[model samples]
Target: MITTVQRPTPADWDSWYTAGWPAVVTDKESESFHRTVQPYPGMTAVDLACGNGQWMRQLTAWGVFVTGYDFSTEALRQARAAGLPDGLSYAQWDIDAEPIPPALMPGSLDLVTCRHALPYLEYARVLTDVGRWLKPSGIFYALVRVADDQDNATAQSDSVLESFHRGFTEAQIDGIGIGWARRTTYRLSARNCGIVLRGYGDSDCQPCDVSS
Candidate 1:
């Protein structure tokens, strides 16, 4: 079972970004994104908690128009300073505090992504919103740290313990997706996992699947 820990505040994120924290995308993450999302030139995507906009940049490179949201002003500032493409934009929005933006009309987006930030948000509500925001063929992708049984025994410091607390167990992750009528797939890595949720109306939607 995963234990609860104090969540990081927006101030904590601002401090980290101000300290020059790097946004690193792993090979597994890139591969999983490409394999699952299969972006096309005209696809539109929304990235939630898009710190530094690294994923936004990647998606834009594949010719997808992306709108990114982050809670930390400093993070959004750095992302903008890094330069935005013609089809990409960033906004400072706190997911926990605000309702889904009115601009994101029902069934308008092709993809919605929440990476490394799902554990911090009210994810059930987020999932429901994403379901409504996406087109019939749209997908919701999330990458999150997974809690392990060995975490408590192997953790070397308070930071490690805090990280453990922030993770969701495989069961917890599975349970969340099951509550909504959608196809759910899991792509597991050593310390993290990727989840893809497709609306039930989608032709390719299935009950569940697990892949490497």
Candidate 2:
């Protein structure tokens, strides 16, 4: 059965093993991912399913106007309590709901990062949505749970990719690799996690850049 996406409050979510944040297994090894999405001074980026706004906080520091969205009120409250910079903002939205308008900010946002959260939804549809939300030349950075060389049996059981696709499709895509290579980027595990696929999307069909 497909589980419905929910935005639980910190109060209610705390009753579980972990509270209201968009985190995967509370593994000590899962490092905090910082999307190195180079944008202009006034670029806008959205952190979808932002757990505790860790990267959200960093993005704002990098001069990108960051907007974080999650269903967890506790997470949102914590983000607010953290006293973010002037350009930082937060909103609540259920991930299971399809085509949510308010959450989809259209062409205004320059980048959208959905780290450690893609396995929970329909990958194709979610990709389509990200494509819709981005500006003509925007970026979508994601970290999906996959069977990349970093898997233990226990970890695999809880993988979001396992929860969705029976198997996974691993690709190193970039702007030049896809139909619209000059306008897209696909950097798989370029930064932190060894298995994570990092994508830098432009207004293209999603490919990779070989020169970089």
RMSD of 2: 6.8
Per-residue lDDT tens digits of candidate 1, residues 1-212? 23444556688788778877644777778877798768889899999999998888988988999999998988999999999888999988889787767778999999999887776677777787888888987888888877755653343235622432355667777775654446445555666788887773454445676566
Off by over 4 Å in 2: 1-36, 148-207, 210-212
Error of 1 at 83 (Å): 0.4
lDDT per residue (tens digit) for residues 36-60 in model 2: 3445568888888786677677677
- Candidate 1 differs from the real structure by a C-alpha RMSD in angstroms, to one decimal, of 3.5
**Colliding pairs, model 1:** none
lDDT of 2: 0.53
